[model samples]
Target: MNPALANRPGQHLRIAALLCTLLLSLLGAGARAELQLLDGIAAIVNDDVVMLSELRAETEMIYQQLLRTQNQAPPRDALAGQVLERLILDKLQLAIAQRAGAQISESELDQAVAQVAEGQGLSVEQLFAQAAADGLSRDWVRDKIRNEVIIGRVQQSIVNRRITISDQEIDNFLNTNSSELLNAEELQIGHLMLPLSSGTDEQTIAATREKAEALREQILQGADFRQLAVLHSSGQNALQGGDLGWRAANQLPTAFAIALRDLEPGQVTAPIRTDA
Candidate 1:
């Protein structure tokens, strides 16, 4: 406490009066702004409307993030449009997920936050401190994390339903090209996969890419790939150290086949994006 405040007998009264004044000022400002944001719609998505408040919040968040990470921001108008469009997509998907009864509980959001913290080698407190430094409130971060989770659920639910194929479809495909499929050369491949899920931010994608490149360099330097994969890979065979044995040329996906086509038996390629 200040020495003057400590010495003064009515210091408590002074502090309380100052707080009351500040609260009143804040309330007055909020009351003025609240009406416009509460009533104004930014975009309409079917039965739901995106409020001006939401657009402003998302734009502010992304604008701050870009300023911090890039040391500069694009023109505000362009950035606001981009951010608003993203918010609209999120609102649409989240509405669908809600209709499908998908929700992220508080515990789940907490766990996701913790996992993100762990991935960055930080504790929860440190993570929040960094987020504060980035001008992100804890609540805002939690909401973003929740949106990501729910969107993943919605996309998975919709895409799986849309793309499901019957056994007869598989049989027909096989029968259509039997000779070429039967005679195609097969490669015995062992590898890792790192999935970059939908709606991930550029910063995260860049960090992940750097990690993958570093691991690639280590593998080239004779570091044990299997152990490294087991430790860091998110691939389905991560527990088996990324061993996907004896895949046929016809069966190998285009990206992998192209990346690995020229490699020798013991060689590993750089990070490949199957989705891309």
Candidate 2:
């Protein structure tokens, strides 16, 4: 058995699960705009309404987060599609939790936040500071963490429990990836990005540059980075305030390394350019 799986609470969080089976079916071309409803219906998952706003926010969040961490522009259509699908699956799981009379509690949410902090190798204070840089409030992060946990529990109750992974599969994974996996150290990071795109027209180029400069000013002025990112960033994790949680340096791109070298804790960069 996977050690992590063995170590989990007797009850797992199923509601937070992102089911592989459902991810492809729910999303469409990854447009930056929210998903529109056809005659006032976005999409039906079992019995739920996924508003365009929710879909858009989640997609933008994923996009911004990906760009900041990966340091590469994702194919918008593909990523958006996948994100939308994940949100729908999440909605489905959330609904199931509701049906089962499951409700999240404040203590549970707090525990989730603590779990996230511990995983990141941060003290609660450090986690809050990082979260702030990403423009996320402690409450929001806690709620998000809680949602994921609940979803995971719900998924396990319904689906994961039903599926069985063979020992051979585990053995194969260990054989192929054990050395690097065992040696890896995880780091949780909160990232925010302001993307400056080159313009076709000189005026447009100037305007984009102005926007980037303004974004930097906002950060300097104590404006919330994640909120601004959510509102203005062209990257994916805008909704989550450009948070790219714990990851190894190898998973990040070269440009990110350069950017990180100059950034002090709690400082935001002026502007960075990338080819889309």
Candidate 3:
């Protein structure tokens, strides 16, 4: 199964959940009064709820981090939606881990926390102090790490059960250009296709080509590629900012691989005609 497509159901659920929250937020003041006092439910996953406060905290943390790192951050609502979706997925995975009897002992949790501190070149107490300065409590950091460990364990177990490697396939892989394949570069491609029907007239075709060229020019001149894609793309992942996700060059179509061959990071390619 294609892992990318496998998450469609979850994606749908996330979109529905985000829209529901958005709708509630837009209701009259009287309707929102109770929600403001009691806090709101961002999403309901199985028996667990993702509270609005939790989502807001995560979203704000990420937003602040992005401000410190990237030149620009995604729109606030978009960032919140992404954060809520991730929380929902994490909650589902945690539930699965619980059912599968996956447990992380206190000692293991302490070790994990220590490792995190070591990675940051700080001692445990210093790490806690820094987290406090960053407005994150020690318990929050520990819980986040614990959940991550559980999720990782559950994902590995699921993959092990679902994957089978035939001896012949392994032998073939080892005998081939294995080193090159292992080191192959993966690219995150964003695409926006201006689709055309089989019987499209030359005039219409010309117009579409012109439009595509204009969009490419816009991207070259510092326009946000993903935003433009979301606004105009006719591709399957249009709603996802036309993201094709990370793909190995060898796994992509010959045309795409060739088109991307000489491009550097952040460089846009010239318009290429394709039969879509």
Model 1 regions more than 4 Å off? 1-39, 68-72, 119-121, 165-276
Expressed as tens digits, the lDDT of each residue in 173-237 for candidate 1 is 96777788789888887777666999989999899899999999999998877656555666644
Name every residue pair that clashes in candidate 1. none
lDDT of 3 by residue, 100-206 (tens): 89989999999999997897688999988876776888998899889988898998998799879899979988888977898899999988877898999999999
Q: For residues 122-191, could you state the per-residue lDDT of candidate 2 as single tens digits?
A: 8888888876765667776676677788887886787666768799968977677667866655555555
Ranking by TM-score: 3, 1, 2
Each candidate structure's count of clashing pairs: 0, 29, 0
lDDT of each: 0.77, 0.65, 0.81
Candidate 2 displacement at residue 231 in angstroms: 24
lDDT of 3: 0.81
Best by lDDT: 3
- TM-score computed on alpha carbons, candidate 2: 0.40
Say which prediction, candidate 1 or candidate 2, comes out ahead on lDDT. Answer: 1
Residue 147 miss distance in model 2 (angstroms): 1.7
Lowest lDDT 10-residue stretch of candidate 1: 65-74
Among the numbered candidates, top TM-score falls to 3
TM-score (C-alpha, index-matched) for candidate 1: 0.46
